[model samples]
Target: MTSLVVPPSTLGSSFFSWFASSSSNNSLNPPKIFRKTPSNAVALYPISLKSSNRPSFDRFPRTKIWATLGEKDPNGAAPLQVVEESSSSIVDEEVEKSVKVLKDAAKTRRVAAEEVLSALSVLEKAKLDPSKFFNTLGGTSSPGRTWMLIFTAEKKLEKGRYFPLTAIQRFDAAGKRIENGVFLGPIGSLTFEGRMSWKNRILAFIFERIRIKFGPLEPLEISLGKKDEREPSSKDPFFIWFYVDEELAVARGRSGGTAFWCRCRRVNT
Candidate 1:
C-alpha cells in the first residue's frame, strides 16, 4: 500500500508517498516524498523543499547525490542540485559533494546506504510495474548478504528477467569503496544508474550493457517518465521506453531470436 498526493504545479507531475518496509526501525520521522517534474523531461522534487522554484534540466549532473533533512523531513536540501560527471573537473557543487562522499565511502557507507534506500523507496512508491527492487546491506564480507542493488525487470513469479547489479566501486575486505562503481544500475545490471532526486526534479538512468544488438553507444543518459505523463492504459499492455533527448526510445527485449518490448503498467494497488 502507498499514498498519492495532488500534483504540485510548482513541481510538474503528481507526487507519491514513500513507504518503508515494516521491518524498518525509522518511523517517528516522516519518509521523504518525491515529485516528478514533466518539463518535456523527468526530474524529481521533495515535498518539504517545495517553493515557487524550478530548475533547468540542461544544467544538472549526469549522476549526483544531495541530502535532505532528518528533521521530520528533508529541509534546505538542494531540492534541485546539479549533478557533475567529470570527477576530475570539480567545478560543480554537486560534483564536489559526490567526490567527497565517494572518497570517504568507507566511513560514509552508512550514509550512502540510506540515500540509495530512500531512492529505492521512491521508485517503489511510483509503482513502476513489472519491476520490483530490493537491496541487501551485508557489504562484501557479509557472507550470504553482499551490498548490492537488485531489480526484477519482469517481477511476476510465473516468468520474467532479473538483472545483476554492481556499485561504482568494488568493496574491500574492510568495506571501503575502491576505483568507484560510478555507473551502478542494471553493471551487466547498472549503467541505468538514476533516481528521483531529493527535489523530485530529475529521474534519469543509463543503458549500456552489451549482450545483444539494439541501440547506440555503450552508455546513454536518458530521462524518465513522469507520473501523469505515464497514462499507461491499464487495459492494454504497456511498453516501457527510454527517453533520448526528450524523445521516446522504445527499448526492446530479445528472447531466442525475436525481439519485443517488455509489457508493463503502474502497480497502483
Candidate 2:
C-alpha cells in the first residue's frame, strides 16, 4: 500500500467541487427573487429604488400621522361629532321649552273652565223666573212683532237691592210683535204700553201661557173672553187674558181688556 497523502490546495479544490455539485442539484430556485412594488397598486409607475428618488421614510410628517388618528385643525377646532352633540343639546332645550309652554297653557284653560262651571252652578241654584222679571211692550204691527224675552239677574251688594236684570229678545216666526218693551216692571206699569191690540190674540195667549208655566200665580186668571162671532158664548176665542181664581175678570167684550197678570212672592236672598 503506497501512502496516499492529500495536499491542502488539492483537498480544498475537491471539497469545493463536491459542495458546488450538491448545491446545484439540491437548492431551491433561488427563492424566486421578486421586485419591490409601489404601496398604491393604482400608481402609474413603480417607485425608484435609488435612495435619492425614494420617499423619505425617516422624515414622515407628524401631521399625516395625526390625520390618520382623526385629528382636527387648530383654527377650525369643531369636529363633526362635537357639532352634532351641540345641535342635539339645542334641540332638547327647545323641546323642553315647548313642553313647558304647553303645560302652562293647559293649566290656564283648566282653571278657566272651573271658573265658568262655578258661575253656571250659582246661576242655576238661584232659580230665577223670566216671566216675573221682564215686562213686555208693543211693537210694529205691519211686520206682526213677537218676542221671546230672557232675563238674567245677579245679586248686588246692598240687601234687598239687586243688580239690573239683563234682557234679550227673540222674535216670533210670523214677524209679529210679540214683545213691546223689555224693561223691568209689570205690564201696565211701564210708561209706554207697547202697541198692543185685540187683533193679535196669539201674542196674549203665549204671554199668559208662559206666565202660568213660570210665574207663581195661584188658580190662574183669564181676562179676555170668547170672541167667536158665530158662538158668542164659546170660550175658545183668540185673545190674551189674565187668569185669577180660574175666572175671567173682563166678560165677553168686543175690544179693549186688561191683558196683564202677575204672581206675588217675597224677594229671595
Candidate 3:
C-alpha cells in the first residue's frame, strides 16, 4: 500500500514512508493464494503510513411510505404495510452518477478540487460492492496493474493538492508482489519492493528491501528483514478501496487520508 506521509526531511512535499519493520506486518496465517517470482525480478520502494484525522459523517434518515390495501376481505384483516423505497436507494443512484463524473474528469485532470472532493465523499458513502472494486482494480486473475498518484486530500478533506512528485505503485496479483517508486527524474529515486496479500477490499504488503540512488552514486540495496518474515494481514497498514474502474480508483489509507490514482502504463526502471 502506498500511503502518503510527511517525511522528516525537508523535501517540501510528502513522500510515502517505506513499510516499517514491525510486528504489525506479521501474520500467522499464510496467504490463501501464493506465487513465486525471481528474487531480483523487481526493484521496489516502501511506503509507511501516517494516520490522518478525518471528520465523521452523518447518515441520512430513511423515509417510509405505507402501501394502501385495496381489498375488502370477509375476515376483516389489517392492511399490509410496505416501504416504497429506501433513502439509501435514492442516494445510491445519485452516487453512481457522481462517480461517472469523477472518472470522466480524472482522464484530463481538469476536475476541480472541490468537485473531486465532493465526489469522493459520495463514494465513501455509496457502499459499492468491494468484490467488483477488487476485481477491476487488481484484476480477476493475474492482477498486474500500475496506477499514478493524481491528487491527495488532507485531513478533514478541507484542502487538496496535486502530487508534486512522480510516484507510482505496481500490483502483481499473480506474483503477490507490490512495488512503489518515487522518481526524481535526473536527480535520483527511491523504491521499495516486497510481497503483497490481497483480501476482499484491502491490499496489505510488507516491504522487504529498499533501493536508493542519488545523482551519480551507485544505487544501494538495504534489506529490511529476512525473507521468511510473516505476511501482512488486515491489521497492518492498508488501503480501503471505495471505487475502481478502468480509468481511476479511489481509496482511503488506514491513515484516514483519501487519494485517487489513475491507471497508467507500467513503469520500467
Candidate 4:
C-alpha cells in the first residue's frame, strides 16, 4: 500500500480534511478516481469460493425483540422481529471504519494494490452487501478516471436462488486498486457491527443485515489463477483456474471452462 498512500505535507490541505471531504461525498460511488492503467494489467477476476459448509448470517445481533407470547397468537413459527437499534451510532462506526480503511488503502504504505484486491475478495466471498447500508467510498466520474466493472451473478441456495452483487472499482492516485461489493437479497438496511483488522486491511467484517450475516475465518479461499489452454480462439482470453494456497476448496469446478476445485488457499479463515 506504500503506493496508495500520499504524504499530508504534499497535499494543499490536511490529511483528515481530505478524507472527511472525499469520503463524505464519494461513499458508494462507482469507479471515478483518475488512474494510470498499467500497460501489463490483464484481466483480473475474483477467486470464486466453493465450500461444502454453507455460510450463514445474523441480521440483528444486538437489539433483541422477541414476540411476547399471548393467547391471541398460536403458531408453530413466530413472525420475524424488528429491533430498532440507534441506526446513527452504527452508521457512525461504519463511516469510521470506511474512513480508516480508505486512508490506509489510499496511503503510500506497503499494503499496495494486491492487498486491496485480497481484502476485497474476503468481502466478496462472504456475500456482504455494502449497498444495503453505507457506501462511504461513493463518487462520480473524475477527470481521467479509469474503471473496471466486475459483474458477478449466480445462484447460492436453490437452483433458482441468486445473489445480486455490486462492487466499485477504485484506483489510488498511483493506479493501485481497492474496492468491494456484496450479495444483496436481504430486506432492510445493513449495519456495521465492527471488524477485526490488522495494520493494512486483511480484515474480517462483523456485520448484520435483513437477510444474512458473516464474520472472521469465514471458511473462504483465495485463488492464484491456473491457466487453461483450451479456448474458442488462441487470441481470445483463456480461462484460469483459481486456487487459494494452504486450503482445500472448490468453487465452480473446471467445467464449461470455469473450474473451482483444482486449487485453493486459506484466507486466514
lDDT by residue (133-215, candidate 4, tens digit) is 11112122221121222211122311111011221122122222222222111211111111111111121121111112232
TM-score of each: 0.16, 0.14, 0.66, 0.20
Tell me the lDDT of candidate 2. 0.21
Q: Rate the local accuracy (lDDT) of all candidates.
A: 0.21, 0.21, 0.58, 0.22
Per lDDT, the best of the predicted structures is 3
Tens digit of per-residue lDDT, candidate 2, span 1-269 = 10011111111100101011111242111121111111211111221212221111112222221221255555465343232122333333333332232223222222232332233233222222222111222223333222211111122201111111211122222333222222221211011111122332232222211111112223233432323323111132223321111100111111221111111111111
- The Cα RMSD in angstroms, rounded to one decimal, for candidate 1 relative to the true structure is 23.3
Worst 10 residues of 3 by lDDT: 32-41
Stronger candidate by lDDT (3 vs 4): 3
TM-score of 4: 0.20
Q: Which candidate is the best by TM-score?
A: 3
- RMSD in angstroms, all models? 23.3, 56.1, 11.7, 22.3
CA deviation > 4 Å runs, candidate 1: 1-17, 20-57, 60-90, 102-269
Comparing candidate 1 with candidate 3, which one achieves the higher lDDT? 3
Candidate 2: segments with Cα more than 4 A from true spot: 1-111, 133-169, 172-269
